[model samples]
Target: MGVVRAAGAQAAARLTARACRIAGRGATSLPGKVLLRLDPAAIGDLARRLPDGSIVISATNGKTTTAAMTAAILEADGRSAVHNRSGANMAGGIATTLLDARGDIGLLEVDEFWLDGVAAALKPRVTVLGNLFRDQLDRYGELEAIAQRWRVLAQSTVGQLVLNADDPAIAALGRGASSPIYFGVDDSRIGLDAAPHASDATHCGTCGTPFVYERRYLGHLGIYRCDVCATRRPAPSVVAQEVQLDGVSGSRFELVIDRTASIVELPLPGLYNVYNALGAAAAAHALGISMSTIVVGLEAVRPAFGRGESVAIAGRALKILLVKNPAGANEVLRTLSLEGGPLDLLAVLNDQIADGRDVSWIWDADFEGLAPTIGHATCAGTRAAEMALRLKYAGVAPSRITVCEDLPAALGAALDAGMGPLYAMPTYTAMLELRRELVRRGAAGDSFA
Candidate 1:
């Protein structure tokens, strides 16, 4: 590390400590508006100081869960893996996390928008490219824009490029690489019968021709063939197939790595997570770990916060999913096909800064189909009335919807509405409020329980 950069990192560590003390919360990513008080070279220089090189994981969705899964795999194999588990995905977050770790295998979860900046600062040893979907249309112009950035940085990266074969946006990222390692689901039973409302990849990235789908796993992902010229889902080196999602029962699938195969069952539900497991397993294999350790680590790891996140409440488990954008929220709602009868729902909508200034994307979500199964719903947040109105339009009876401005009251009403399990879907900031409410209501004991 350069002298100036080393000094900057030390300064950042000290400053991070000061900020934590001032805020009374643990050190976290600086607010975007907060003055960035460090040398830009400090992050890159510190990465060199670590024994194990950096691993950068980027995606529109699944980045957090994939980061957790990869870190758990590394930790289970007895490697010290450092990560930003607090959902901090910017330059300061990466810098502060690296500063705190001093030296460890850094599994950095970075935002798609900040990939270039973070990559220029921290030249990662391995980069995992998960599928890209249309999300936060205002912040990110389009899925193609993020892919373009990845395309540029992939040339400069010194380590393995772990790409997703199912996502053509991610698949095209490996165009110039020397057979970059790929991982995806090869199962037929676990995908959509045809394209659903949320599928994005219709036109080929390489050519402008419309891509034909042989099968679709989730949204915009599946084995596809380009009709015009040459563009399709890349064949992954490590693939998962014969996948079976048993809803509440969990998912069991087979993994093929280095030509060896094994059956593994993840306690987490949904098909998207099957892809998450594949991404983590592929990264683990690239890290040179055995299949056994990968299997155990994956099986042992639990879900991430608000991404198919579950909590035990009132003697029943409540699944809390963060429905921030259209594609992600649609996928979560689509997973409802696995649910049986009517389900209790708690939806919180807010225009908080963290939760995007615009909440209009709720209309794009497939809430109409999901509304029928919703037995009772408590709508809360700054936009609680808006959400209640939305549910009403989606065929939900006005009497079935409860609008409570306060989170705790809304949560209580939602919980009391049904003896069946509850599903809390909220925007980003609203999820935090629900978590706080969960703690305050003694739903979870003290201390973020």
Candidate 2:
């Protein structure tokens, strides 16, 4: 009877998925939502089917790219993993991934807010807790709240843990795990002069006192310590050292696992990506993957969608960097400042449900870094005027900022009236809309599962 019920639920899910596609809607999460409606136990049941079990990755930023990198490494090691590659990372998304899974192990990027529930369901063999930043305040609340919840989840989980030693919030989760593998960037050359205004990790988790930044990088992620409590950043076993960032091209760094060093030429730009690679390598190391395979796979991994994805349009290249919150946007701006020539930008701001309806988060992003190098900028999406205003206050010349509520018009204008490399910075839903527009114009190929 249990087998018959499970088979019936799977059939219903497939039928719903087909219907969604035929109705001009993408078959991403609707099928899973339908399946869960039919069988609440579907995610756990499907996750259990994998012979080698599953792995879960959760973070405010970089989880998608990190998961992709981990999957590439595992695949190179001849272990196939069922991955949630579409970037739909909620419960419905997890269910969809598991329902269509065909691999030895499951590799899932669980949304930070949904991690507890999904972890409860899958009970994965390894749980990778990446950095947590202040994102979607309208939805996820304060960073401390999310950290408190994760601390509980970490304590309850029986799986092996992989954590980012650079992020204080993530590193604190290690206390709950029996044994945790830690990863971070060890190069001081990439450290920031000071923490940005938008930095979230201001206070210590242990003492509630302010943390003294020894070295800050990409917001509050860096070497720090609580002077009062003496709590400091964890020393990571797997670290990236001697890092070099090539604007819009890629990066080069040494991957050090337990003092064993190997040069890794990753094809993704920014110090943020270095963190992603480190997190992926650490997770793979916990699963017994060789360091050689980790290096080879990382060097071959491409940008996941709008996270530095390049799209060519009419003899010029348009680089898309997805920026939804303050910390991630700060990294993109910092990376852009490193480029040689002036930048032409189409910055899109949206207030959709997926992008957090409260658009005040844009004010928190540090756009001041790019003001020096910005050639011409166009703003688009539901809140284009707000973004243009942000640039104006960031010291960009009024003549350099253009506001177009429509994405296509903004993208076209930025390309037509600008010089040098073009950069598109869009919120999550805006990225989807822009991609659809690019596909329509035959500028980008149709995305597949």
Predicted model with the maximum TM-score: 2
TM-score of each: 0.93, 0.98
Error of 2 at 209 (Å): 1.3
Top model by lDDT, which number? 2
For candidate 2, give the lDDT of residue 71. 86
lDDT at 56, model 2 = 93
lDDT of 2 by residue, 1-449 (tens): 28899889889999988898899787878888888888889999999999988989989999999998998898889998989899879999889889977999999999999999999989999998888888988988888888988999999853989898888888888875787888888877888886788787678988899988888877888888999988888899999999999977889999999999999999999998999999889888888888999998898898897788898896779898999788888888888888854788899999998899998887888888788788889999999999999999999998989999999888888889866679999999999999989999999877654
Q: What is candidate 2's local distance difference test score?
A: 0.88
- Candidate 1 lDDT, tens digit per residue, 346-433? 8999888777777777887778878888888899999999999989998899988899988888887787778968888889888887
**lDDT for each of the candidates?**
0.80, 0.88
How many clashes in each candidate?
A: 0, 0
Candidate 1 weakest lDDT stretch, 10 residues: 31-40
Off by over 4 Å in 2: none
